[model samples]
Target: MGGELTWGLPVILYLFLAGVGAGVGTVSASVLLRGGGGGFGGDHFRLARIGALLSPLPVIVGTTLIVFELGQPSRAFNLFKVINLSPMNIGSWLLLVFICTSVLYALAFLPSFMPEMKHLSDRLERVRRGFAWVNVPMGIGVAVYTGVMLGAMPSRPLWNSPILALLFLISALSTGVAAIILLRAIFRRKSADPATEQGYHQSAYLLTASDVMLIGFELMVIFLFIMFAHLTIGNMKYAVSIILPGGDMAMMFWVWVVLIGLLLPGLAELAYVLPRLLYHRHYAAPVAVEVLVSIGVLIGGFMLRYVIVVAGQVTGPMGI
Candidate 1:
């Protein structure tokens, strides 16, 4: 097996950052929708506002980085020029749509921040409300598209799993939720209501729990996927083995992707979730656990894209 060692960095970083950005954006949207009396306590408007402000920064940066990685930036124009049904074309269109919607969504979030713009912000909010109807689906489309982009590539064993898209979507949601939690922790000190603070913490904990579970599901799918790929007869199996412990990207696959990426986060989540079962008012411990878990999950998310992108290009079509 032989290939250049170039495709690794861009593909992995793009996947990780894209998922991170979109996930945060989507979570902020969800927080806004379920805010007020319906879900957890807090000035949901305020928290949502903060999340909205911060969400797109990462998405925009991630997208730009990805464009850079695609080699010649000018060639990306071909994506929109043609409406072919290829995944590349579809992803290009989907990303364009997602970026536009996310930008609108993120911008619509600014009105509540300034007194002078309050009235205008309200109008934008109304407009954003309408946009939300479209944005939600588009957000999901973007998250799922990350996975689908890889899954569509049949030639690459590591990218062939149908579950890959779902995994990426889940990762996006998890990191997004984590980002909000961290943001709330970092801010909300000045005028944050006690009830709201407690509620935000709880909501953060609950969502982190959900993220942990979803990540578990993702890991299981990955396990099944690798096993499926390895059991197959031919290049697929040959390619699949290229990252197994002693192979080309072994350290990345096992240490970064598996342990730090998946295992540690899962365990950290358990560290908090289990405590809740034993007692209540356990906010400090659990909250701390959630924050730590978020960091781990974010790292794991990065490793996932890194391994898949790097490993796919490493092996020959089949074992030579």
Candidate 2:
């Protein structure tokens, strides 16, 4: 492996999952704040509730994966010692703060599920609303930090681009929307009130529309990332080669990341959304298609992090 990374799958998974955690947290907070005024079990509340519930799990799991992958998991806590300007220092604190706020945000939804806790709903709503403000900036920090952590690794030219942070941030939000849609679809299998059901479909449409635009932006960022590297000389070009036509990770990047992850999902969402927008009618696609789109987005998100991590190692600094 020489001077290239000893880091591997665990690191990639950590990046993907961390982005998911941050993404969902941001979406959950935003939805809670902007959606209609309704009580705990109302249509508007269910989606946000699901998102809040999920926001913490991925981050905690990703953090655990990285910590355990270290030879000594206990030493992971040593990161707390330095609170300086370093990316690691800032990211460490960011992740810690995000985890704490996300947990509180999730807990704030508890009263919604418990009829016995009805009296506490108002107080919980206030707490949850307060956390939403905190979650947005923290979530963005966490998402951008994942890429910045890689960008800080100058020895790996592929990971050193300034655009990587924005790319990951966009992907994180896209995947987060997918995750929420997937969960909402799964949990709402049984029939409900027509109005509530209509609201659910409408919400999914809006989210899908947003995700399509995000995917478009992601594709542009990726192009810029490649172009930036392709224009450089020597090792930088070598790094870009890993994802070009015959490069080692070409199939993964072009086929999985670009095709399945970004393009297909965007087209699928657009197909469903364009008609609804044109006609002013509330509509959603078949459940199976939505499921596939969500799954594809998630698979694409995972492949992106994996390919970037692996390719960065395969084409890195010249000598051991």
lDDT of 2 at 308: 86
lDDT of 1 by residue, 1-320 (tens): 46676665766777777777777767667666655412222445655666667766777787788788877887878778889877767877877887787788777766656778767876676665665566667777778887887777666767777877877887777777667666666664534566756666566556666666777887887787788878888877878887775677878778877788778877777666666756754544344565676677777778777777777766546543
Q: How many backbone clashes can be found in candidate 1?
A: 5
> lDDT tens digits, residues 35-57, model 2?
76356765568778889999999
Q: What is each predicted model's overall lDDT from 0 to 1?
A: 0.70, 0.87
In candidate 2, clashing pairs total: 0
The deviation in Å at residue 98 for candidate 1 is: 1.3
After TM-score superposition, the amount by which residue 127's alpha carbon in candidate 1 deviates from its true location, in angstroms, is 3.3
- Using all chains and alpha carbons, the TM-scores for the candidates as numbered come to 0.85, 0.95
Model 2 TM-score?
0.95
